[model samples]
Target: MGEKLLMKGNEVIAEAAIRAGCRHYFGYPITPQTELMHYMAKKMPKVGGVFLQAESEVSAINMVYGAASTGKRVLTSSSSPGISLKQEGISYASGAQLPAVIVNIMRGGPGLGGIQPSQSDYFQATKGGGHGDYHMIVLAPSSVQELYELTVDAFNLADKYRILTMILGDGILGQMMEVVNFRDEEKIETYDKSWAANGHKNEREHNTITSIHIDPAVLEQWNIGYQKKYQLITESEQRYELYNCDDAEIILVAYGSVARICKGAIKEAAAQGIKLGLIRPITLWPFPVKGIEKIIDIPKAFLTVEMSSGQMLEDVRLAVDGRKPVYFTGRMGGMIPTVKNIMDKVMEIKERHS
Candidate 1:
């Protein structure tokens, strides 16, 4: 057990990763997530770890790929534009079945849009950002505590699945200060490097790490095998938090910082005699689709709120499968919607239904 201490989400992420036994971090500084890089730079060396600020996001991600190939727990952090640059490397990591952690403190973007918070990358992340028939395990953190916990979980899940794992956050979640209990140093397990590409010594054969396959059938088989792993993860690793749904007539679907704001609105709506509940998705890729579907049969409409132009709403619609109406409320370009605004929307939905 550990005592809770106040810490910024970005700093907590870096600290937690180190405590979780990650020894190598390669990242290029980007806004909103810069605190994460600074924290790593100052602390990694003290713990006999490596922290390198690469030339660009491209270089940083490739550096991470190299470290991950050696079966070393490695990490990278960036905002939207920088993350876009790392997409190619992220795809390679997935295809090569290398376990690594990448944190995207999402910012408004189609291309270099803004430095503020946004959930526009939901599709990019959940659907495989780079070109390929591949998927990364995407974890969404809605609080500073979750940021700390998910960073540790991201590393563990990546290694367990032999794939890249991403902690999807936003500017507010990255910058906010909250109480978090840091895990003990001894509680973390050291990774086994039997599969890692640490130079082939005597009695060991050369281990090559790559995604390139010349044979079509062989590549197809590899893709099929990876999909099976994804299916297993989807079944066993879905994460979400449900709030006050026992007698609810309406449900709010949100994630990251947006989900936290939705929680307040949900509470207020309940006070006003509007039966509202919240479904906050913690793991975005292995999305809590099945869990959400189970609640859809209760005869309630869903409001998908986000910091983007309805990116997550599509997922909600898919999960609901048209059993009920799914509405969308969003604000783009870094605007944070107020609790009153969300409550007002909930009221509108309630009035319409009534």
Candidate 2:
């Protein structure tokens, strides 16, 4: 336990990663998330860590790959367009089964979109951003406090699972200020790297960290092994926050900054005698689909609010399994959707149900 201090979500995430034992950071400058890299530059040196501003996002992610292969804790961060540039390295890290953390302070984008917050990367983050038969452990933070906590958890989970882990946030969540409680600096656990590629001089034989498999049979075996790890993650890592769900006849499904707006809307709807509740996901990849399935019988309608066009709505539909009607409302290109706007959609859905 520790005292709370007001901090922006991006700064808190960088500080939290340091506390989680991250010693190397490589990233390019990008709007909304630039503060994160700046913070790391100043603080990492003081803590005997390395922070490098790469020439491009592609170079930054490859730097992450190099550092992570050394079994050292490493990270990279960017906005949407920058993230797209890192996809190749990201896929390489996945194939190599390297443990590393990546942060995306999402901005609107099919290409070079606006700097404002948006959840348009939902599909990219959850469905494997790069070309590959793989998935990263994607965690979404809705508040500054959760940003800190999840950043630490992201590192731990990445190390434990030996895979890439992402902290998926939007511009609003990245820039917002809130009080955050940080773990004691001395109490953070140092990762044990019995499997890391440190050095093989004094050990048995040399261990090479790579993804290239020349033999087809060996590649097939590796794929199966990786799939097994992913299955374990799916079963054990689903996380969500439920509010006022016990007797609600309608549910709101959302994540990231959109969830905060939906929270207020749910409260107002409750006051107006509307049986509305909220299901906010913390882990987007292992998405709490089972938890949602358990409550599907209670809600006649489920409304999904997102900053993207309609990415997360697809997950809601899959979770609902056609048991109830699912509706969607979205605002694109870096615009924030308001509580009133979401509530209006909720009201419309309620009326249609009646």
Candidate 3:
């Protein structure tokens, strides 16, 4: 621990990326998450880093792809609609196997719906946001502190696997202020980027980086390699936090800030002699199936709470796989589900099961 500072989640993300050795940032302005770009603009030049405010989200992500190809740590961020625009470039990055960190501070959306917090992009982030048999490591941070910690982890994971990593947050976590402890002497890990297209001088062969494959057979092999990498990541990187799950009767499933709210619900339910537990998934893509598996025979049912219309409910259903009944309660278009809302659903499930 070096120093503690009171900062908003967006600012923490910007600072953490800097500390994690990121030197290139490319992004456009968008609501709720604009502060992250603003912070980068103010800090990057001072640290001898590159921060370019591109003309559009599409331009920014392509810039990121260019920077990443050079074996440099790079980052980009946007909200829902802006992230949508970057999907093509993200897909391109995935195809090329370039490493970069992308941040999505979610707001209500199907089409520029509103500038309020939302987890509606759960499916978009966890499932392939871009396209073509690919997945980015998706991390859902529940607080300003985690926004700092996970932003660093995002860059590390991206480099470690030579793939894209996504920090999936929402407007609340982006705007909310909290005290964050910065690591002064944390060792930033490095990887072999000999595969990067950063020029080999006259010593070795010049490295070439590209995502284009004209032949179907070559593309099929590329897809197979990507799936194998994804499987390895799935086996090694599933992360989650379980609260009071050992003796839980009704387990609550959630991620990001929604999971924070579920904790409150759990406490309230406990006071009323109801045993409620929560499973907070830190990595949305891997989905923490192992964590759920450990207590599969314990909990009678599951209640998945979200700020979207049951987007993550699909994953929970697959994880449970009919061994236990799963239920859902959510609010869309930026309405957050309150603790009372969660408890109400919990009580309803208890009644049905009883």
Q: Which candidate number maximizes TM-score?
A: 3
**How do all the candidates rank in terms of TM-score, highest first?**
3, 2, 1
Ranking by lDDT: 3, 2, 1
Candidate 1 TM-score versus the reference: 0.97
- Model 2 compared with the native: what TM-score? 0.97
Give one digit per residue, the lDDT tens place, for model 3 in 180-290. 988886568999999988778888998888888899999999999999999999999999999999889999999999999999999999999999998999999878999
Judged by lDDT relative to the true structure, which candidate is superior, 1 or 3? Answer: 3
Query: Local distance difference test, per candidate?
Result: 0.88, 0.90, 0.93
Q: Decide which is better by lDDT, 1 or 2.
A: 2
Candidate 1 lDDT score relative to the true structure:
0.88
Question: Can you tell me which runs of candidate 3 are displaced by over 4 Å?
Answer: none
lDDT: which candidate is best? Answer: 3
Collision count of model 1 = 0
Count of clashes in candidate 3: 0
Per-residue lDDT of candidate 1, residues 84-142 (tens digit): 99999999988899999999999998888988888889998999889888989899998
